[model samples]
Target: MKTVLIAGFNGSMGQQAVKLVNSMEGFAITAGLAHHLPDSDPTSYGLPASTQLFTSLNEIPAGIADIWLDFTVPTAVYANVKYALTHGYRPVVGTTGLTDDQEVELKKLTQDNHLGGLIASNFGMSAVLLMKFAQEAAKYFPDVEIIEMHHEDKKDAPSGTALNTAKLISKNRPAHQTAPDETESLAGSRGGDYEGIKLHAVRLPGYVAHEQVLFGGAGEALTIRQDSFDRKSFMSGVKVALEQVHTLDQLVVGLEQIL
Candidate 1:
């Protein structure tokens, strides 16, 4: 069995990871790491009594887990994954705020350690497909924009999926301005720009996770959209990563790599 260590165990996605690991046949929870916990009692968090719980990175014993599954916040995720890699744990990261330089550093660490790791921006199949489709559409239609919506509590703007979509679209679409230079009556109304692609981020109480890629060509327009109604939609992709991560020799970004 592959022993798993879950970081940010108290958060929503972290709790989902806990459930998914427990339900999988060949995976077991070895420990949980959180930035802070009221009590050390494992039962309080619905974890097994034998599973070790740690509130600090330094306190986690090395060699306790084979895989480090991270769902921590943007602020803590980079450090958490770095600690895991240095301590001999394979990282399967779902947390999305890691900067490009941070990822490059982590990739170097993985190579030096000869370890396997994955950092996925979105772990939902629909979201993954949407990015793929958006990349394909960009080749034909260079004029495109993206809008991503998530729950209000999400810590990052221009959700990782949206940013990743823009990166993918940039790969196929050349660098060129799609819209004319116009001043907005209100400042900051055009959304963020990524290599000429306009990316709009929406955060509201009722939304789960959704994205729309709009493309305009000539007199016609095309829109591709995807929605993740529940967090469970991501677990399947996580499971796939867990089962296949060991096959890789270096850290790679995107769920599409494994798929």
Candidate 2:
């Protein structure tokens, strides 16, 4: 049985992880960190009473944890991920808003240290498939654009999902071509463009997570979309990462490699 230490073990995803481990026979939990959550919020989320609540990662005791599950905020990511590696622990990070440059540096650190780190922008299998499909289709429809939406409380604009999607799509395709427009009235009317491909971000209440890829062709158009209505949808992808962390000693950025 794999032993896990949860970083944001008081939140929605953390709670789900607890239940998954509790119901499953092959895994056991070592510790849980609930730094920023209210005392009562974690109860419904399935955090055990034996779990210790702390404001920092420094409080975690050494030599007992196998996997460090991070479901915390983006700002806390670098510090915690570093701590895990320094202490010879594996990490499965689901936090967003970390920069591309930061990711490159983390990958290097994971490689140099020979420690495993899994960082996923979106932990939904369908969303992963959407990215894969877009990447595959990019060769045929090189003029593809992306639109992403999420809950209003989410802090990041142009979420990691959209950025990663654009990056993947950009890798296999040439920059899309748009006809020159002589009309100029509203500045920023065309929305933010990545490598000549348009990207739109929407933030509103009552939306979980959604993304769509619009591919334009000569007199023909193709569209691909994926949506997650509830937080539980991400658990499957998280499970996959946790299962794979043991055999890896390198930084894995996407779930694509495991899939």
Top-lDDT structure, candidate number: 1
Best by TM-score: 1
User: RMSD, model 1, all Cα superposed?
Assistant: 1.1
- lDDT (10s digit) by residue, model 1, range 51-83: 899889999999999999999999999999999
Name the regions of candidate 2 deviating beyond 4 angstroms: 40-45, 178-189
Those runs of model 1 whose alpha carbons end farther than 4 Å from true positions after fitting are 175-178
**TM-score of model 2 relative to the true fold?**
0.90
Q: Tell me the deviation in Å of residue 24 in model 1.
A: 0.9
lDDT string, candidate 2, 122-213, tens digits: 88999999999999999899988788989887777787778888899889996567756646578765667787778888999999899999
Output the worst ten-in-a-row residue range by lDDT, candidate 1: 173-182
